[model samples]
Target: MLWFLFCLALLLGGYYIYGSFVEKVFGIKKQRQTPAYEKEDGVDYVAMSTPKVYLVQLLNIAGVGPIFGPIMGALYGPAAMLWIVFGCIFAGGVHDYFSGMLSVRNGGASVPSITGKYLGNNAKHFMNIFALVLLLLVGVVFVSAPAGMITNLVNEQTDMNVSLMSMVAIIFAYYVVATIVPVDKIIGRFYPFFGALLIFMSVGLITAVVVSSEHTLLGDYELSQMFVNMNPNDLPLWPALFITIACGAISGFHATQSPLMARCIENEENGRFVFYGAMIGEGAIALIWCALALSFFGSVEALSDVVATGGPGAVVYEASFGLLGVFGGILAFLGVVILPITSGDTAFRSSRLILAEYFNMNQKTMRNRLLMALPLFVLGGILTQVDFGIIWRYFGFANQTTAVMMLWTATAYLARHNKFHWIATVPAMFMTAVVITFILNNSSLGFGLAMQTSTIIGILATVVITVYVLTKSKRDLFVNEDGNAIDDDGIEVVAQDS
Candidate 1:
């Protein structure tokens, strides 16, 4: 309990301290008009209040990643908690803030466009394909999971027989409407309600565990031994824990989600609260689930057994009902059902925007929106039929790979402007090694090399990339007569306007 409370406090404190420091480093200009106003198209760039934007962004990036990821990570014991706190504070918060704020500074441009602006056109093109494929996977995966859960929730709650396909069709239809509609209509209006429900569920479960006489919190886990390997399978903590707890820590998916809020943010200053604060909020959710998992079951061994027999879904359902009773059932519905549905809708919406931005299509018209959206839905619908378990396995890698790209882009931006670049540079190098080591060491992904060999190569790759990026950032930066910095490709580093 002491360690849990301390970790939770660190998450909140990091928001006010590290979040603010990153905000200052990014240099938000209060007088400057944001892209929300400058690129007001009503479909995507319409200005919104800070609170509303924060909720939408929270729901956008946080599908079930925080909850499910942490539940799985809890199998490794309290070491997961340490990652959630520090990773969210230093890596996730900064990654989210820059991804969103840079878009606002660039007229609500998509991640690929921003990457292209900093990393070069080739990167921009690669990210376009990479982000789209990832979103499609997210869209497909979210649909299947939620539809199945909703079907089960409905079947058990009432006598009504809800078929999985019917639920899938309904969710697919919602995604289409949510994807094409204006920003404030569907996503902006309902996300706050969904976000509230998610928070309520987390809070309710935490309170139940604290008051429960039958069980204690995080039984027998020591801070001194927190970093020790506790994985029942004896998997190394390095790449596995980092990949398992992506959203709770740092996610490339957040970068893709950030541009959505960046287009709606009313001011540059709000980026801290909306982007960084939202990630911290997610970390808190992860912490609560981790503690509950560790304590709710008799011990870490019990939790591992539950995972082996029933998976994360079983753990979530059993824990919810066990602690909160009937109310837990409803909360489970919200956690498994509503959470992913919200993210699925936005994944498609983001795909539409990315397509529009890439092709230079005018989305002000319904025709253009439909043209860009229809194909993604068609592809997503078809993907729902195939076995994507193999493809989904790669998402963790792809997700972190995108994070590496965004972090490097951010590092370049900071270096070009002469602000503190090490903040991003350090994490960029760290995650780059994580991704490299993960693929190399994992049997399904790479050569199935030993961890020792993989770690050495990963570290060497990180060094090479860092040196090249730093040297290129120096060579690419040139000041014109107007004193505005420009890159080697002749793109303006900072817009004089918004």
Candidate 2:
């Protein structure tokens, strides 16, 4: 009961903090009267209303990571939920909200462009290359795990050939929505509704799990039992915890979504409501999953059996439904499917934006960019053939590393602008340190050495660029010609401009 109450308090506190921060930073009166650039046709930008902006933002940020992260976190017992919820608000939510705000202020630039502004040309090029590589790994591997699970769901539920059915379903659903739904209309109608549904479902699911379970006490299970059963020596709780939190806490995927959503934000005040609000919603989802895991499986052995028989999604579905039978199962399936849609759309939009910017193509010609992104999707579909868990693990590590790089660059930029207060800097620094520690603690000799090499290069690039930017701050700090202060290389800085 106390645990539940604590979680509720955290949720309410997070809402307050996120909402207050958004209003304080990007309130409506600060929004620019008009965007600096001419409105592009065909793209969602000019047509987006406030409601549409809200929905698209919600959809773009929701992904499979949140679903699985909390489940994995439960390996450390219910105590892990505390960290996942709080860490998300303080570390993940802030990182995402600020990233969007920074991009909007800069004219809707991506993270790479932001890095370039604070770090320099060389750093920008390196980080962009790194981000692209990481995103490709993320898209293919990250998308595949859920694809496989959805395939399994189709095979079990409807007997429509597995892979083919999953592919057709995904393509058809996204295609119909993308083609018919005006981008702005989609955001307006879908965002708030989707967000509300997400919250309700999460609360309902958590409440159901907690209330129905016989065990009310928090840590009665043995720690040793957590690692008892395994194929190879069971993986430690720390590795799983780090990977799980990485997925939930700070993902590189958020960087991609931040810029894509920036173009349509109704006003600066909306940044807090949209970006940070969505993250809190995601964290709530994570908490529900964690709670479900605890209620359904009392020990690690039980969790392993569930995963072996049905896979992680099944474990999650069963956990969510408990004894409600068919209705519960259907609801579980629908929620899982809906969760990934937001992430997928954001990925598609981000890729298009990157391609458009790279070629200096007009945003009105985004159909051409969409055509370009198809091959990448095909490549991702092909890669789905590999083991889902292995691919997911690799993506999780890569995603955290990419996020750290982004935060490092963002911290430098904020410092230059006199916006790098303790609130932002402390969490950013802690996340950076945590990623480094996780890497060092988990890797074997060869893999660890490679990670160390990458870390060194990234650190050196960031440091050199930061020193250079600080030295040149007098020239570029408040200037508009370079697009340095507002939009980092043309990405929108949501809060700054609003």
Worst 10 residues of 2 by lDDT: 224-233
Question: What C-alpha lDDT does candidate 1 achieve relative to the native structure?
Answer: 0.86
Tens-place lDDT per residue, model 2, 1-498, is: 456567757876886965576446433344463231334344545535555565566666767777777766665666667667777777777778777877777777888887777767877787677676666666654455556666766677786776643564575356334523345555445656666666666676666655565543244445453333222225554434655666465676787777766766656666776677767767767777766766667665676677667766777667655634567766666666666655665565566567666667765554665665665566566666666666776677777766766666655665555453344555655555555545655554114444456456545554554455446543455645645454334444444433
lDDT of 1 by residue, 1-498 (tens): 888888998999999998888887778878889888988888888888999899889899888788778988988888889999999999999899899989888888899999998878988999999999888988997898788777877788789998989999999999999999998999989898888888888888888888988877865666776777688887788888898888889999888999999989988878899999999998998899888888888667899999888667778888888888876767755665688899999999999999999899999999999999999999999989976466557777888899999999999888877668888999999999999999999998788999999999999999999998877776777778997776433655566311
For each candidate in turn, the TM-score is: 0.95, 0.81
Evaluated against the true structure, the overall lDDT of model 2 is: 0.62
Residue 161 displacement (Å), model 2:
4.6
What TM-score does model 1 achieve against the real structure? 0.95
Model 2 regions more than 4 Å off? 18-31, 34-42, 47-52, 141-143, 158-182, 185-193, 213-240, 308-310, 444-498
Best by lDDT: 1
Mark the regions of model 1 whose C-alpha exceeds 4 Å error after superposition.
481-498
Candidate 2 TM-score over all chains jointly: 0.81
